[model samples]
Target: MTTIERELHIEASPEIVYEVLTSPEHLVKWWPDEAKVSLAPGEPGTIAFLPDYPSVPLTVDEAIPVSRFAFTWAEDLQVTFTLTPSGTGTLVRFVESGHADAAGHAENVRGWDHFLPRLVEYVPTTVAA
Candidate 1:
């Protein structure tokens, strides 16, 4: 299992969804670590999850506003998040890929299950404009 992808629809605008994904403040919530990570591409960041989850040192690889974000994950994996406008809501696509071994892939699959719903829950319901 070299690649895993999941999609989520949240009741927020793309910009709002994008902000939650990139902001260090919000990332700290669902990401399960306390690290001084920046939201800019090429920046280096570290995520130290609970000991059971281990820590991942990463570099911001792609940071396009209100659309896409990608970062290096641990040693041989890259994680990417893509956002798109979906009607009055936003669509979030999360992808993980690299030369990860089976264990890495399975752990990440479980990790996403743990975190992304937190992301969906973090977003507020859309207000009529």
Candidate 2:
């Protein structure tokens, strides 16, 4: 199995970053064009990337406020976000695993590359607001 891992340092507290990760309202600002998900573990939800793709189903596997949030989607592919405090900000470690092939893995790498930066940019604005 192939796993895609990324680390980001954002100038926001873990609690704030956690909200951005789990809240539908906050997610759309940086991730899928639309998000319909619950923070409770085992709950099912869907996120749509908009015009280009259909909604993808996902199940919340874990939600550990300010520390970790994880979900499983698309053939049991799992994405985990681990956050740790760093000075006045948060360090986010993102991991996506269970890819069946390199092609799928690479596609997600590109996808995350494009979207994760948005998270970095969006979070700070929330702090200011």
Which candidate should be chosen as best, given lDDT against the real structure? 2
TM-score winner among the candidates? 2
TM-score of 2: 0.96
| TM-score list, all predictions | 0.87, 0.96
What lDDT would candidate 2 get against the real structure?
0.92
lDDT of each residue in 1-114, candidate 1, tens digit only: 489889999999888888777777777777757665677777887777877646677788888999998888676688888999999888999998995488867887888898
Alpha-carbon deviation at 21 in model 2, angstroms: 0.3
